[model samples]
Target: MTATGDADLSVVAAALGDRGRARMVLAVTDGRALPASTLAGEAGVSAATASAHLRRLVDAGVLRAEQHGRFRYFRLAGPEVADLVEALGRVSPPQPVRSLKEGTRAHALRLARACYDHVAGRLGVALTDALLDAGHLVGGDGADSGRRDGDRLPGLDVVDYSLSADGRTVLTGLDVAVPDAAPVRCCVDWTEQRHHVAGPLGRALLTTMTDRGWVRPARRSRALTVTDEGRTALVDALGLVWPPPHGPDRVPGERTALSRA
Candidate 1:
């Protein structure tokens, strides 16, 4: 077999070599399609500078751009890019919590929120537990797997997730339609120092919950608020319970919000 030209990894590495461009990529990896101006602010650079970097990322195939009237939105090419960002985040040192607001936001993200297209925080942990306990997910039993005996509930160390045969039956019974083809992947939550469901199944769960008005996003922040209906549904459908009287508090620097996952 002939060698397929040089790997694109070099190009990807070069594109991410700049601190500014890398930050831009991280900002948009949240699964939010962002305009160049918003990305510029997130990268702390001028719009012109961000545009130049964005062009490089687009050319390198690390990002994709879509134009809507006057605005051009950019996002990571796909879930593969999200996976790369999450892996890098796992090894990268955590940023210090600078202010009371930052600390609060971080806490909120760790409690209940979305990381890109998937869920994270305490809400995310709870959902994962409910799925596992209900036998909706399986296959985390190998020696190399993250799960351990005697672990606490709502643990986020799952190596992989899949809809069990019973899970499909349960979903069908609940009238929650699932796609014929869905991807199964994991993402690391920086704030919680744990992993959460990502990929198709994860996205599906988020969409279902949001559509059912079980949860809602807090204004101007990535934090999620569980509604009364959400609490009842979670308990009734998945056997999960929310912590009572939940309130915001500060977490240390090492554990912060998930950047990519």
Candidate 2:
């Protein structure tokens, strides 16, 4: 890399340096294009202040604005931006919870939330664990030699995950229309410090869960809640017992033995 490249990197870093701006960036990390007004609320900033922040982010190429009729919406410049944010989260310290609402929101996010269009948090890590235990997915040990994409760089938390034949059967049974030749990958979850499904397979799973009302997004937030029906269905289909039994031996990301319905 050249000196000019270092300067360019610093510009992007500066755009994400502010608390308000960082909040705004994270608000859209789930791949949603949000209006400036909503983004301002997310950042807890006045409209004028948010406008300046958004402009800086746009100028730094960290985010892009789209004019949708009378409204302008902002989103991450691309998947690379989202990836960068996720990477940063892995090393960032948790923000202190200052209020009951903040504490609740924080817990909810750590329990279940979306990470760039896929299920993340504990729910995601559990699902990945369940799949692995069931022999539905394989090899997420950050060994790039086993990675499906040979040319791809061994970036942050690059796990060599792939779907097994049984995984195809499981998705088909769940009525998740697997995209043509979709790649299965895993992301090292920032909060859980464990693997969660990613790539095309992860997107398909999230879509299926949402469509089936298994999980619903929280209003104005990326957190998700599992429905009653979903709870039952997940157990029957994947042997994923949610709200796992409270016990001294309970492990994070642990799931019941895979039981096919």
Question: lDDT for each of the candidates?
Answer: 0.68, 0.78
The digit string of per-residue lDDT tens for model 1 on 1-261 reads 877986668889899888889878876665778889888887789988989999999999889999989999998898778777766765677667999997897777667876767776777755665666667766542112234556533233345466788887876675666556543565555554554666667787888888889889775455788888888887778766456212122221112222211
Q: How do the predictions measure up, each by TM-score?
A: 0.74, 0.85
lDDT top scorer: 2
- What's model 1's lDDT at 58? 99
| Cα lDDT, model 1, residue 122 | 70
lDDT score, candidate 2, position 52? 100
Residues 56-141 of candidate 2 have per-residue lDDT tens digits of: 99999988999999999999898778778877997899999999999999988888888877898877877776677677777653
